[model samples]
Target: MNSWLEVLKPEEIEEIHAASLEVLEDVGVEFQLEEARAAFQAHGARVAGSRVYIPRLLIEQALTAAPERFLLEARNPARSVWIGGGETVFAPPAGCVYVQATGTARRSAVPADYIDLVRLVHQSTHYGTNGGGIVIPEGDFGSDEEKFAWLLLAGHWYSDKPQMGLNLGAKVSRLALDFSRMAFGGRPGCRILGTINPDSPLMFSPEMLASLLIYAREGQGLIVAPCSMAIATSPATLAGTLVVNNAEILAGLTLAQLVRPGTPVVYGNTSTIADMKTMAIALGAPELSLLVLGTAQMARRYRLPSRAGGSLTDAKEPDMQAGLESMLSLLSTVAGGVSIVMHAGGILDSFLTLSYEKLIIDEDTGGMAKRFQRGIEVNRETLALEAIADRGAGGNFLDHEHTLKHFRNEIWRPQLSDREVYQEGRDYQAYTLAKATQAWQKRLEGYSRPVLPEEVEREMLDFYHQRFGSEPVLDV
Candidate 1:
């Protein structure tokens, strides 16, 4: 019941695994950073100049050592989540450059927009964890550290769930780790979760490798994801892309375990095709769904959890095209049995823009998938055999106790994305936009900021002062 669709048979899974092993052993992968190359060489991987040929046995060893499941401890203990074991977690869309809403002009996001987005995440029932790097807030920062400090602080200030941010550099990521130590205060296990992306065509960037090493040492959560464009960065065929993508992910996993034997890493991906005519990345393609399905199968083979797929669309607005494409992509991701889907909401124009209106649409779309994911509970009470027996054949059960008791949990309702509500005076297109706008306004107006202790808030402020010139004037 985990998925309605299956892409790879058991034998096909073996074939893909063998191909990836061959690629890792014979073809080798380039390490753009000397430090990462040194780690592999130190761990007995054969290094040829800047390229490193990792042994298949080492890959198997790492896979055996990596945990099948783990806890990501949040700042609020009650908000902590367990990843893997077929359980899925949803994070709102993040890392978009531009922000747009219905009837409002599109523009670069500032600090206010970033804070608003974080607050919106805090208010949503659909998001399992707080989203991070939601916007690259506009600021005149003295350094990258300064910029990162403000952004991560905003994330902490706004939400209590597990959060994420840029993980390609060492200095800023380590700083974030230090902040987390203060935010969560020595809670056991993983408190920090991050996404470290590999350069497609089999390479890990210097910055990302540095970040990965720090995360591994800190016992933080990681999604060892590679974002490879099918025709551009990988072989055009889907099978070929999977082979490359798997090798890249395995190399990262191996490195994570090498730094720390039991490092928690998800077998992650962002592999999608390039549009033939436009040369733009095609996230809404049918092949993208297949890619996710295949990736999830490989992850299961290694007994690791998986990540990828999203409410993605190339449409510039939250219109009919966006709705259709987003629903299809979100459903495919859930059916693929993937975990920790990134960009699951608010993406538009292939990740160039984040539409507030679209975020509402995307959230509702993902909510539908979750409703489906709950499946059916066939217990004695849920079976309703007694209820039917109590009420005779001709008599209705609408007024019965069973119906009254379970009606709310039994029904799936969409607050803002009801397709049935679109047939009246307005088009589905216009209704969707208007409703999305209306939903966000209500959420913002209604959400109350979480209270922070005076001492902890002051310490966070001191950390802020060390990074930026002055202490932040926060509402919390």
Candidate 2:
């Protein structure tokens, strides 16, 4: 991870600092709601209509008050994850519709489908960590509350890693907390990945703020994702947009800290742009790649963990375009040293449709990125100068003991993928997509669902029934 090139040098970072200060001073952000305007005004900001001018000193003070690192606790403490100021961590993709294939066809994602995906991810040795409930099924129970319910159910079913809470209204947030309490059997800090969405112009909705407050008071981790679109909703310039986005994140962080000091928060940015001609959000543009890298750097500057948009593609089909775009964004974020990187797969055209095959392909891409982050070996054994001298010119290293000692450690083995000769293909004829599909099927077949105590499951269900007035449907 440290081997990757520094996108911003000291001078560049200084320039960004100056730019941010200028943005705060001159190009102030607007808060359309009067209450938010009054809050900022009361906090020493200069408010003119919807626009609020924040001084650099306040920004610095907020940065100082914010934490540099934190832990995301899980049902089991062994599964808890630490983010910030360390090796880059990879998380599977979040929030997509149909999972795409390498081929043109796509399939709708259901709650059960996401459970299977989670099982497969848990089973895979290659995937770094489990993020959350995979996909929300499109059906009669597609309300935001139901979506949050599904997330809670999925978290209950799986306990291998830190599970993410679904993004929903404040009522759903309370229900999710209830569900977590029931599933985990204890109310531990940082048990769930609490989320809050901030709309553009550096402001969060009241409901979003309320949800974050709930998580903060509980001492759980909070992920604030402000979906800023360049040239339409957010500023066109990258730096300009980053200032507004960073300010919004800082504001949320301040509130969380005020509620509970040292509360875990991840700096998240899904800032993108809409193509002017067609009004379609451009997920594959170079600007997005830049944003992914720059936002990562900004997160580091704030001394907090970062999550950014990824596995994005503009391709209608899961082909070269999809692979290229996803790889570019994924590599940039990983290289930029983002912790808890999100959106690993199942994304297209601003996260509307999810491609299953694309998801599988992204898993493979993530494997490659992880390999890159492992980087080159620097030890004497890796250098192999003595071996080179002893072998003289052109001797076979494959048969040597040194090769035997290191080859397995040096090489990465891939699953659900092939690297065979074409002439030997008839017996091994499956393509990458077909193999991935088969892998998922095999995973589903072999999975053994974790056994929660019957009493605990009943208690969770009873709580849901008490809250929502019905026996909660368990999709697992």
Candidate 3:
């Protein structure tokens, strides 16, 4: 394949690494959890209260011990996903609390919305990683315990694809592990993956650390991301923000290694720029793609799998702006060699809302990105010298067997984008919106919930009931 995309020189990457090491050694990172701090201290890091000064030796050791790639098992064996190497896996939008449709005002999402989102994910052809907790229905769900349980159970009920583990806290995270064991059995390797974020500006929060420790000890895959907004939580300059981002990620990665060596950790980045005047984060900005490229390069420098990019946008609705921003972000993501793509679809309003239309549109965008990542084949048959000679210069090759045999594999067909000539009455944007709306509704109409084995379903329910006192409701 082609070399893909890059945003930094080798020397620049080295500069970032050296600067990060200096920060870890001198400035230090705060590990809010005592266990995390203790783990760092035992691994030769200097500790003062919550601040842990991780030395270069520990960082290097951690880098050496961390695996480059790992497999995540799914309820269906065929749906298992490998989360590294040159592969790019797309996940749905996360943490959105509102739902929006075209020409309608956004509103608080309910449990029904969450379940439908899961169903959309289950039906999507492009989204490979099923990220549970795609949208949190805080307005409807009574308690954190109930909400987290519903998210986990809903994912099991709707999708057999590989699901992301919960990381809200140690308790919920451990519950996610229990569910994974119950559903997928006690097989080796990572059964599910959890996402953990640093507090940015050189800190790890207590809840995040608690979940991180649990995931590390249990040998589950972890994505250590730093979602610092430039000029707000981080430095105004991209390079400066990168220094802070790299440091925080390294600190978390080191802690995970200290807790358990050979842990599968994806170097993750959701860091983006804040509009200077308003101070609001802009996920759609070109700077986000630059950050994605830089983050992926940094991860590659350490020989680690990386996570970045998505169909991210600042648009409130699934309109033109959403499509433009989503394509740019996703294209850069695939070109930059991102392994796990979070928020790959169904996001709108700077992640405040999840739009069903965008999910369908972004899948087409993702298909295009994947096709581009495949690059072009140039050897003998692909060069088409025989086909050219068969047709000669003036005549067309439409009837040639070579054209017939090659076109299907060589061309990428979009599911949503129309290739036909526009009729006189059709409006392109309106057509897309109509098509996407129809598409998602049709999917939900035809959706069939995957059936878990009877005993496994009973065990998962029993575990849920034991953890949360009330009898759980499965119907959404």
lDDT of 3: 0.88
TM-score of 2: 0.88
lDDT against true structure, model 2: 0.70
Q: Per-residue alpha-carbon lDDT of model 3 for 1-476, expressed as tens digits?
A: 67969989999999998999999999999888888888877777789999999889988999999998888778888888888898999988888999987777898988888888888888787888675688888644558867888788878877899988789888889878877787776766688888999988999989999999999999999999999999999998899989999999998898889889998999999999998878898999999999999999999999899999899999888878888998899999999999999999888989889988888888888999999989999999899998898888798988799989999999999878888886997888888889999999999999998888898888878877776676666686
lDDT of 2 by residue, 255-326 (tens): 566566677888888887878898677888878878777778878777878887577778876667877888
The segments of candidate 1 whose C-alpha lies over 4 angstroms from its true place after superposition are: 2-4, 419-424, 473-476
Q: lDDT score of model 1? A: 0.84
Maximum-lDDT candidate = 3
lDDT of each: 0.84, 0.70, 0.88
The per-prediction tally of clashing pairs is 0, 10, 0
Stretch of 10 with least lDDT, candidate 1: 417-426
Q: Is candidate 1 or candidate 3 better by lDDT?
A: 3
Per-residue error for 220 in candidate 2, Å, reads: 1.6
- Put down candidate 1 lDDT per residue, 82-155, tens digits, no spaces: 88888778887777779998878779887788888989988887677775588776666676677677778878
Q: What is the lDDT of residue 276 in candidate 1?
A: 96
